[model samples]
Target: MRFMWLPIVESVRMYLQSLPEIAETYEVDLIGNLPKGGGSSIEIDWEAERGAAETVNTTGAVAVHLLIKHRTDDTDIWRAFREQYRIQNLILQEIRRLHDYILTNLKIAVKISATGVEPLGDMVRPYYGNELILVFEWKGAIRDGRYES
Candidate 1:
């Protein structure tokens, strides 16, 4: 609820604002643990198929349940981010900039892993709760940015 210095909070806010850039750089509609964002949005679903585990291609919505977080303790967050074309490229630039800042200045590394679930057979049926959890790891490095033991 308080701060010893202003730079601490300001630095935190800067890091928080970099979420959108990171997501777009990785070609994902949304990403990161956004501090206090996500206001309003919409979700778009399409049909597509073809993965390493599939024999015959299937057709279904190529989207997942857009994550919406509660703004406050009482109000529920109904935001569903729909993929947009025009802004993605611009966002990527910012992502890369943030990445550089993290790598060169912050001396930190980030990794993300994502998984998905599909129908056992090809039926093109609507499935429930098919998604994956992306884990992000930030390994802090030394001042020289070398691997820290």
Candidate 2:
């Protein structure tokens, strides 16, 4: 039996890369582990996988984290908040587009299960940053698989 996690991750990366907003706006990285550092960047990381074998098919869900970060040196708190908010909206718009694209092209089920905002304070003297965490649950299937003892 085989899990389709890696393929789905790759597909998502390719799809995001194809978007001009995401591609041109931030540095995109497919990290094997949780991301670090503070900057304007988009990091894709695989969080976890859950599955079960039922008769002839295997069903599972893979959790992918899309981390969007925006950092500013401006001391104005309101300006930093507004910038992060704007960036969050832009990323969410693209994600909504991706949801439709996945349904039509990949023939897989995808949903945004959770979202969060992380404030990483002061990496280099008043470098205020906000990180948006988007958790995408991707449902996938594996056919013609047999469990061997």
Candidate 3:
């Protein structure tokens, strides 16, 4: 059985990279994984949860965590907050596009389960960001001793 995490994550990264607002504005890697060190950038993290399985098929869910981070030296806290909000909205706009893309292209069903915003750094560090959680459910069929999406 081939796990779907790698393909799904790669597809998401590619889709996000196609967006100029994300690719041009932030420092995204070729594969969209988090960089070695933290800076102003966008990254992705994911986990898979297996569900009930039958003899011929199985069900599961994958949670993709979209992290958007921005750092500024400006002392104006409001400006930092505003920038983060703007970035968040930019990401939100692409979510629908991504959902449809996954369904149409990857043939997988995805859902936006939840979203969250929180401070990344304290008064000393100047980092601001939020984490958007997207949960995607998938079904796989077992054929010839192998699994197919």
Measured by lDDT, the strongest candidate is 3
Q: In model 2, which residue pairs have backbone atoms overlapping below 3 Å? A: none
Off by over 4 Å in 2: 32-39, 52-55, 121-127, 138-149
TM-score of 1: 0.27
Better of 2 and 3 by TM-score: 3
Candidate 3 local lDDT, 1-149, one digit each (tens): 34566667777787778889777767754325566445677677887565644455555677777776777777887887788788777767767887778666665556655556555543233666666666777677655554467
TM-score, per-candidate, Cα-based:
0.27, 0.64, 0.73
lDDT of 1 by residue, 1-108 (tens): 111112222222354345664333322233343332343221112222212233232111122222222112222222111222223223333444544553454444
Candidate 3 local Cα displacement, residue 135, angstroms: 1.6
Model 2 poorest ten-residue lDDT run? 140-149
**Error at 107, model 3, angstroms:** 2.0
Best by TM-score: 3
- C-alpha lDDT score of every prediction, in listed order: 0.29, 0.60, 0.67
Shift in Å, residue 143, candidate 1: 5.0
